[model samples]
Target: MPRNLPLFIAFRLLFNARYYYPIFAVIQLDYGLTLPQFAILNTIWAVSIVLLEVPSGALADRIGRKRMVVIAAVLMVAEMALLAFVPLGSNSIVFWAWVLNRILSGAAEAAASGADEALAYDSIPKEERETVWPRVLSRLMHLTSITFVFVMLVGAAVYDPELVNRVLDWLGSDLVLAKETVLRFPIYLTLLHAVAAVAVTLSMREPPLETECGGEASLWSGILAAGRWIVHTPAVCGLILGALVHDSVLRLFTVTASEYYRLIGIPVAWFGVIGAVFAGLGLLVPRLAEGLVRTGTPRNNFRIVSLISLVGLAGVSLAIPLWGVVVAMSFRFAFGLLNYFTSHYLNAAVDSRHRATVLSFRGLALNLGFGILTLFYGGLLRVLRDGNPVEGGNDPAYRESLFWMPAIFVVLWIGWWYHQHRRVHEARP
Candidate 1:
């Protein structure tokens, strides 16, 4: 029960619970950026994260984890400031500002990815970890879900000028805000959270390294060593592989959730409410995950998660109006469970020496898998579009894509499971 534990939870809440998340795409588009430009900016963000993920983790191992966490917090402040204060108009400058912002944001994400969790996990006494860590994780998840619901609701509400003006009127304010003026409101709120994260990170005490090998290794050597360790360690490798399968597909659906909602007869205005509901649902996940971890083996837990995903995806494919939202929402449970299980298992298996780097590898694999899936999805959409000009809209392609996702996940999961099983079988004495 060190101070780092609570600070770690607070830092995660502040660092990740960005108010702009609910209206991310809309804010960018409202800033005069076209959809194509928005897409390109996101691509840049993803590439930056992929490129920096492992290197940052390696550096965190060499340097202090607290140092990296502080750097990430500073970068977050800078990124949010770019959005908070960039002047309207001047398209070229604004676009470039966003580009720089994305790069900074990605770097921040990479720096914080493994270092924060590793730092916190290392703070606990070794003897108490197995019994205590699950409870800590469960508490963190519950708090995070509450924070997300608050952010989603407040963020979406403030993004609308009319909504803000109504509040102002009730408070006897004479000033009225315009759409452009209020568009940055969410960014401003996120900036405050970023600042709070910096304070929390600054206050954190870096626990003594559990392994002598942490600071002595070269960056390249550290990464290579971690890579080799993962390959040879069946449990760790299997955890990452299983996480990759679940994360990439679920994330793809999560990102395109708005379109899915529209197709399922949900109005655009209710999107924020739906998001809040989803976040609220996250409150139930940590308890269930804890119970599963206590009673079930990793194989059994993964099987349960796989079943939930398969059923949810199949139901989504049916595209039942309004009712399909429930099915779509079930993926949240699968996703939450997957995240908790992977974190618990991966951290438990990896050594403290290469902990951050291995976690970074997990992040890198998940991102790469998502990127590949996104490209495949794009190709699938194009093929669907070319095959039938009558249904020129994207809705048909989206439906077709939904229909195939579950099938694709099944094939991939089977292959992954078989490969892991073979590796285990061969390694046995």
Candidate 2:
């Protein structure tokens, strides 16, 4: 039941995200903001995360993890509800609302990140966390993928930015009712957030706290100490680096990939179908990763999976069709092979004493990846759009997204493989 909870929540998020995604895209259109404006908003979102990641985790330490998660869940529900109802079409109100939601979400997330990791770490015996962590995340995400795929089909059928106003016109409905109808998807999305918050509150059991000294240290001191600890282990640093790239690629797909599909003339409903196709791969690949782990270290399986994933991603970077995103997701799931592996590295490398501090930086590393990805993608979009990148959505520039992500995958994989090899030799009798 406990393991099933995260998977259920993951699906809920994707289901919810589908509704807001278009809302996010169309709000800019509604407000007379261009693509650049959207990018700027996203940039702000990323910055909020990057700035707050460590501090938020530290807050978790101070106030306790469960409190922060509950708070985060509350913020998510409020934020989504506010977006679904309020008409902020051309005002700073919408922008600031977005910013506030993201910051709060970050704070809430910070509390949970370490706590969740720690919780899962504790669920299994100390020896098993290495093996169990990846499976746990994969299983949850896999369950989420199946849930989201179906939800995507539903979302694609219902919530559409392009035809939303048109449907409203035909129904001859009042604007308020029409808008509320359009926002239904997000309301359900908010419900999912509430559900996740509740789940964490009730179902989650705390991981055994580390005996590490960082628990009592000042925030800055803890953060610096964690950084120092990270670089000392090849597998640990590799895991952190891989997570950043992994998140970047996934967010890029999550934030803008569907819009690109619509631009290419894939039907809106079809977009949801494609969502299933991509996410469906999530269900398949983690099981395969679990199979691979029976024989290899997390690092070894990571190398094998990363190489295959890069190949798949390269196809994604090249294809212009909606199916390309499907292919991209295929590769993306393959990379997940290392999640459990690297999780093991982090768990093993950190003494119980400073676990949350080091783990907070783990969250920080991933957020930094998210920040860099947005800036790069935003700049790339701007460049592709002839210096008016913010002038609303540009269909032609969607393919340009293919260029940046694949190369980064290559560089990170090579670095990770080298480190793994060196570590293996060092451990020899």
Candidate achieving the largest lDDT: 1
Best by TM-score: 1
- Model 1, 240-334: lDDT tens digits are 99999988888777766766776787754566677788889999999899899889999999999999999998999898999888898898799
| Per-model TM-score versus the true fold | 0.90, 0.79
lDDT of 2 by residue, 368-422 (tens): 7777777777888777767434333445675666666788667765765676678
Per-prediction CA RMSD (Å): 2.8, 4.6
**What's model 1's lDDT at 77?**
98
Model 1 residue 300 distance off true place after TM-score fit, in angstroms: 0.9
Off by over 4 Å in 1: 33-39, 87-95, 211-217, 379-400
Clashing pairs in 1: none
